[model samples]
Target: MSPEPLQTGRRRRFQEWPNYRWAVLGLTMAGIASTSFPITVLSASLPVIADDLQTSESAVSWVQTAPLIAMAVGTPIAGKFGDLYGHRRLYLWGYALATGFTVLTGLSWNVGALVAMRTLGSFIGAATLPASMAIIMTVFARRERALALGYWSAVTALSPAIGVAFGGFMVDAFGWRTIFFIQAVPSLIALLAAIPLLPDTARKPEVRFDVAGAVSLGLAVTGLLMAINRGPEWGWGHPLVVAGLAVSPVALVVFAAVERQTADPLFPLEFLARRGFVIPNLVTFLGHMAYMGTLVVAPFMLERSFGITEVSRISAALIARPVGFSVGAWYAGRVESRLGGRAIMIVGALTMSVALAATGASILAGWLAGVIALLFVAGVGQGAIRTPAVAGVANSVDDADLGVATGSLQMIGHIGAATGITIMITVLGPSESSERFFAIFLLAAAIASASAFSARWSPGLGTARSAGAGRRSRW
Candidate 1:
């Protein structure tokens, strides 16, 4: 390239800036928070929205359900595209389209419109999950990525909690639609800034886009997630639910076949064979099962066992988990350099298991304080695993594959959380008794313990970083 073109490119990318990486991380997070907060914030206003739209709460609940299913199906595809095109390109397009949908969401006239807008917004916005991680991994050195990812994990854990707490207040004061309108402003700003400041990741244009694999995998995941999500409401015997359940495994088998034949697979089937790649994802899946299961049931436990029905008080009690999560992520990020990723993951998962088991005991004894404190510890445990787990998986893959790799990991985690929530709710099953709650929690605890044991096999990022210093570290 000529000198003038080089100068313009540098100006556009701002790579010359000493702290450009941090700037990218901040702007990326700002954009993410704008979109993500609404996911949990809407939960606080579901009843209000149902009444205003003249719809049943059951009908309006699709606002939450739809986005989740869309995200689960879209995450891997978005990541794959980023690997084939460019992370910055995917990020820019995704945020721009998502922002447009957010505006539409604010203007929704009915529950269906609201659900449609949020679902489309999240479907496109899912690109940001892997794109952001790829960008960070691209910008930072191997040894430095853990800390950057720690902050990322912290924000991911805290954004929803903040949404539920402060967002509820905002909804009461300004109305639900206003929240989306406010969200759009920051998202737009972030998009504008990202255009100039963010750098792109490597693209594999030589490799063919795996349309067949993407389609098969999308069908497989969508069917499974839809079945799991609706089985409780529609009944497992419902034809649609049974069809979803039946179609999913068949689709997955087809997906595996498609991936084997595809020259460039959407998610490389070979990665599944690697202990480093597979075990960390399994740990993530198991950990989320326990954490999310407990989270879904905690409010009910409080309401039934302690008569703690006040929204403000319940919100206050629940905030501890995310707060502790933030702390644990920060601490783990800092210490992963010394203690190593696998060890941190093991300890974190163990803490979650222990905290949850104790939480069950606390509930049985009517110790509300103990229950709240244990929940915080559980959050910390979950948070501690986030950075290391992600780092482990990211390092295991080639740089070209980071987006899909991390996206797959995230997808598994989301599925685990959904499965956990479903299982816990099923076990609790209209029962208000403390013993029933305790027993269900024990199951969650057992699930988390399984995760802890699984963590023992996680790839060691700390060791990999230490062993390889000058070149890109692949664990």
Candidate 2:
């Protein structure tokens, strides 16, 4: 169905609920899928990439890690960039560069070359995602925001899902090279789609890049992100790696202090103060961390433990998310308007925790059906939290600041995912079993449950009248 068009005072996309909003959303969805697809597509092809390029698993892992780290570094900054420069140019360049890099990765002759190529895509992928959220939130209004966000979130979720399935197909058919080659098509499509649809929003001329603030965050984020990504290979004890870990906390402390003092903070203090904002973001961090931590292990459980082929396992695991995410998000918007954003988020978080716990327990008990069911349940939580979270922030902030706020949330989410993966590798030992894995799943469940409850903290529902005032003091 065509989505309601953007509210441009013109009969845009068929008098739909979110008319032109739908067109923008379509680009956002496509962009997200493309960001995730490149990485997931390469995952099934990791073995293939390693063999042909004479590389190790660690090297191939960079194809995924580089982009994630780049995203982590770029998301918040890019959000502000979107706010200042406009989402259109950044989104276009991001997708265009991503398509270029995908091509580069495809033709790479060695692991080093592939990583370098992936880095370029990673940098571009970095720009696309958070900006997509910022652009959507800024354009949509309070009432319809959540639902629009929900569907947008679904598309983002689906990208990884589709990539996982598509990756498996390409691997099973031609070879791993098809993963990169196929990704080029969607990236190009997104770039083309964004051109006519994405709105033109300009930045304030006085708004300058916080170079000092940027450096502080860059140093801290790079240190932390590098440590997290490398934990699997570095044994968490290497001196350089240890420094990266040890310095991150201190650096962040310093960064926070600096942000608080700077005339114009890189991340505004008021933005973080809203209870709804803070809690939802925290919840997002935990959810991403837990799910990402487990994701690396799930393919193995599907293929090795359950005796499924790579393709079926990929499709089953992935396809469920897009379906659930899209449906749940669309519904949540309706639910949020009637019940409140807080309620919807709480429900999502709780459902996620319970589902993960169930999935783990069922795996322990030899119940394949249970695993499938729980995965879908986790999607329920995802659908619930994501759309509402974005919409709530949009409602809470004035139109002008929406892009920055969206960027803030996304950056936090990326950090959480990175940190979770780090924890997973750190916890690794020889005694992995369904039972042990169940324990880990329960831990993941706890994170999900926490996410559900965190909704109460957002200022989205509060009566703070100041456009974006007083919020700076609270966080």
Put down candidate 1 lDDT per residue, 101-217, tens digits, no spaces.
Answer: 999999999988999999999999999889999999899877878888888888877787888877888888988888899889988888877776788678888888888888888
For candidate 1, what is the TM-score? 0.95
Runs with alpha carbons beyond 4 Å of true place in candidate 1: 1-8, 11-13, 462-475
Any idea what lDDT model 1 has? 0.84
Among these predicted structures, which one has the highest lDDT?
Answer: 1
lDDT of 2 by residue, 24-93 (tens): 7776887677657645566666777788888788768887777677767777777777777677667777
User: Residue-pair clashes per candidate, as listed?
Assistant: 0, 23
The per-residue C-alpha lDDT of model 2 at residue 199 equals 72
Q: Candidate 2 regions off by >4 Å?
A: 1-18, 303-323, 459-475
Score each candidate by Cα lDDT: 0.84, 0.70
